[model samples]
Target: MSYYSISAILTSAQKVPCTFDLPIPNRGFLDDNPGGDIAAHTPLPLPLYLAELLAVQQLDNRPLLTLDLPSSLQPRVLNALKADAKSVDLRGQEVYFFEGAARVLELLEEEEVGDGLCEAFKKRAAEIADHARNARGGTSSGEGGEFLRGLDEWERGLFRAAHDSSKAVRMWMGEVKGAK
Candidate 1:
């Protein structure tokens, strides 16, 4: 979540569903009705950064907006992750799924989503590590290829690090054996 992290910037651009708690003038462009006032209780898909900012702002001791969970963290997706984290196409759902979820959770504080994401990441990390260690010069096909293709930005980084580490370990072992 650093200021210059590309992932953070992308996550901030993700859209989250939010409802306006109070009507505001000259804000209908957000709902595709430019030059008009946004009606109270109007639901709109706003970028995470704007939504987070408005959600926390107090207008007469009431929040300006109510942020809802993004579609990526909806119940159906969570259920799929819970059932089989390896099977879920996180990249298809969102390229920065985990990072965006972390941001949204910070605003909404949903324990279930947090727990589900942690469990899914743990399960998928083990699978990713296995694939990384056993990879044969990117020759994976069929199921493995499909799974690898579905990895999000974070998961892809994890896969790359794990793969490189495994390769390094193999190289180190070879050097040690040759030294003996």
Candidate 2:
């Protein structure tokens, strides 16, 4: 996806009501686009939930995105992730929400290095909320939300890196004929 699209997604994501109460970061300002700036969104610090939501959006928008994957990687790797690809049959069309989700979870697995994101997310999410508050010059009411947030830069980077593959996003598009 283009940088601009990322910005747009984030902007819309704010409306999605993340389980975590972390505030949405601004889209930034650019001279060219006075209304809003996509480039200004750089150095972006996206919370895990927001990123997942964006990943979901990206997945749902593409019907044929899965076709780009190497046919060899289909069943051996994608299906190995364990869930069946039933978007079209079930969700009406090829909505890759689940596939993108699987890949993002895979990222957490790799980055946490078996430490497991569950514990880390519970601990770090609060810290991230603190960091975001500090950056915004806003005050925290000492209230926390239900869902977790707050992945550090390294953690956030890993979460994002995994989603870089459309292959991962569309893993459920339907396994390759002979890919086992």
Candidate 3:
């Protein structure tokens, strides 16, 4: 097994559809392009949920708000976070969403650690959704939809982080690997 570790700071989180941003390093940015700089995103926050989505899609390398772990762990870490997305709920959701997001912070620690936990959470959420659908004969209205929409926005933030981070990660990983 490879000995790798990752660590990240939330950087930013705001209420009413909470959003968080993670900062990327310049070195990572420069890896992809000759003149690339992480500073370009300065003063602008990159969403964490969006970051995970991009990682899940493999549209980018790793998220900008990543740990200093081995390059190989990016996908694994991202998968873990995506798996956690399933835990979202519409009823009294934001409160739970915050908790759920916080819980995944450990997964953000690295690509490999606590990966399956996310899968389990997501699986359970899906089952609950299925059960609700069966009971209601369809989806509910009002609060639930609103909450789900909020969740989507949160996910978009993650996607944003992941996409931005991916660029930096990919660039850096490529250079480091090439040099090796």
Top candidate (lDDT): 1
TM-score of every prediction relative to native: 0.96, 0.20, 0.23
How high a TM-score does candidate 2 get?
A: 0.20
In candidate 3, what are the lDDT values of residues 26-97, reduced to their tens digit?
Answer: 443323535445442333222444444322342145343432222222355346446554433322333233
| CA error at residue 82 for candidate 3, angstroms | 15
Candidate that would win on TM-score: 1
lDDT of 2 by residue, 1-180 (tens): 345755333333321112212222333331233455343123333443444544344323442111112221234433322242211121121122222333344433343322332443334434433433342222334332211122223334333443344334355444654375
List of clashing residue pairs for candidate 1: none
The sequence of per-residue lDDT tens digits that candidate 1 reaches over residues 9-34 is 98899889999999999988888888
| Model 1, CA-based lDDT | 0.92
Model 3 Cα displacement at 96 (Å)?
A: 18
- Model 1: worst 10 consecutive residues (lDDT sum): 134-143
- Each prediction's total of clashing residue pairs, residues at least 3 apart in sequence or on different chains, is 0, 1, 15
**How many pairs of residues collide in model 3?**
15
lDDT, each prediction = 0.92, 0.32, 0.39
